[model samples]
Target: MLVRINPASCPSDGHLAALTGERAFCSEFKYRRGMEIFGEGEDAEYVYQITSGAVRTCKMLPDGRRHINSFHLPGDMFGFENGATHRFNAEAIIETTVRITRRRNVLDAMTSREKGAMNLIGFVTQNLQHAENRMLLLGRKTSLEKVAAFLLEMDQRQDHPDMMILPMNRRDIGDYLGLTLETVSRALSILRDQNLLRLGGATQRRVELLDRDELARLDA
Candidate 1:
């Protein structure tokens, strides 16, 4: 249920247009790293799809700790809400571009041609499923297990060849994985030392999973 909302008529755009029967219904916007896309408690008037880079959706707890609900990478959608207002804040993790359309327009368009509403259903289902899985993973997993699971999740989502490029940094990964930044780094270093994976690139974001089965065993 990903939406690649490029302004040009790419294959993703064509697929969406076929579903909604409306061509060129969305507009694109760009945000710099750390820029706020939308804030918590704001009106949920639109739906957004990332064109490039990444965005983090999060909320602050009473203790001032931020818990990240999810990350939206290129070709993924966000900004859907159950109520009139947004429950969490959304910010660009890097220089990112996103296409957006009015929620009402989406509903009206679905009412017409895409009676299946499979896109919306699938999107919502995945969101719920991810949340449920994270609740368990965060509650009981050790630092090594959490980081290993994180790598596996990113590998599945990004579909890169042998190497996985991470867009977010250590602090962002810590926030999402419920660990301290040092703990995240230490876990990755341990995995690299064990030859379960190798971290490369100038920023060390390029990750090659050497033994996915071992990572899976730890995750299990």
Candidate 2:
């Protein structure tokens, strides 16, 4: 979903480049770990591109459940809405920096710059594909399978190939995968025991896929 907002209506933050009448300039801002970038139902005034670190976008249910929609990594873009307000909350999963531009400016560029427009389409396509895959993971996969697939995903997204340094904690992973934190922890322990992965780091955020092929088979 995409939201379009007038640049003049927003606050005069130095982080907003469109305030200076630039066509596509963006200003960088820093977000501390666990800081909320935007909240559900808030005005969708900016489109953000992550320069470093990671972010999680999630929806809160009336019963206080959270369903994480996606995790945005460095070089990833997020915070789009189909209406005037956002439907989910976005927060930094780690200390992060992002460059933000007005949604209006980005929308204007979509029509004027061919390359920019193509990039938007490509990014949207990727999100759609990811959503489909996630649906399958949530609806059909078992607890073990879901955890395996998630580890593989983080491994790939972290771009370390076979090893991963997870930025989010067990509760976040549980919420994203529709499992209890105990379940998530148990699955990782089981995988470790099976020689599928090796956990390092004091907090166990560092994980090395010991047998990628076996993990892939387990995920399948």
Candidate 3:
């Protein structure tokens, strides 16, 4: 099943206000590409929802390597922490705008409304499922398999299904998949030469899956 986030389709303030009996305490903030939104171990005072553009949540290793946990596209909600501190550092993958609300306010609102609590539970459950699937992908997939899987995921997540325009860079992809940047590039080249996909666009971020069945077989 293909699933994508669309900010335009997100519930308006009215719907949320109806459920919680309180208006959402939201404020819009903009960040330039590569700007840090929040740092690891920082206080988790707020929950964030993407209004436009993309964000990457990552952690820095002791060896100074970066490990990307996930990408937050438009309409995606993130920054839910189990404790007071953030576990990952979040940054803008491109010029982005996000709506942020105080975590305490959300919890207080949910406490009064059963529907709101259930919605929050469902949202967190979906994120956990995605994390589990990624764990499996990273642990056992081959280099080519990983790249194919990543492309398929991007296709499913993007606003456009026919043409995939990735927002993140090769380094980000490598970090997410536990591969080197060179490995990721080589895999894409191999796939293109095999006629499984066509890569276009100035930065080669746009792709069209030529033989999706073959790509899926490779991913499997």
- Candidate lDDT scores, in order, read 0.83, 0.80, 0.83
TM-score, per-candidate, Cα-based? 0.89, 0.86, 0.88
lDDT of 1 at 131: 87
| lDDT tens readout by residue for model 2, 26-46 | 666778888888999999998
RMSD of each: 4.0, 6.3, 5.8
Clashes of each: 0, 1, 0
Candidate 1, 106-142: lDDT as tens digits: 6787776645388657667777899888998899999
Candidate 3: stretches off by over 4 Å: 1-23
Q: On a 0 to 100 scale, what is the lDDT of residue 67 in model 1?
A: 87
Off by over 4 Å in 2: 1-23
lDDT of 3 at 197: 94
Q: Please provide, for model 3 over 1-220, each residue's C-alpha lDDT reduced to its tens digit, 9 standing for 90 to 100.
A: 1123332323334323433444565667788899988999999998887877899999989999999999988767789899999999999998888777778877788887878877777767877899888998999899999999998888777753788778998989999999999999999999999999999999899899998889999988
Question: Runs in model 1 with CA error above 4 Å?
Answer: 1-24
lDDT of 1 at 169: 91
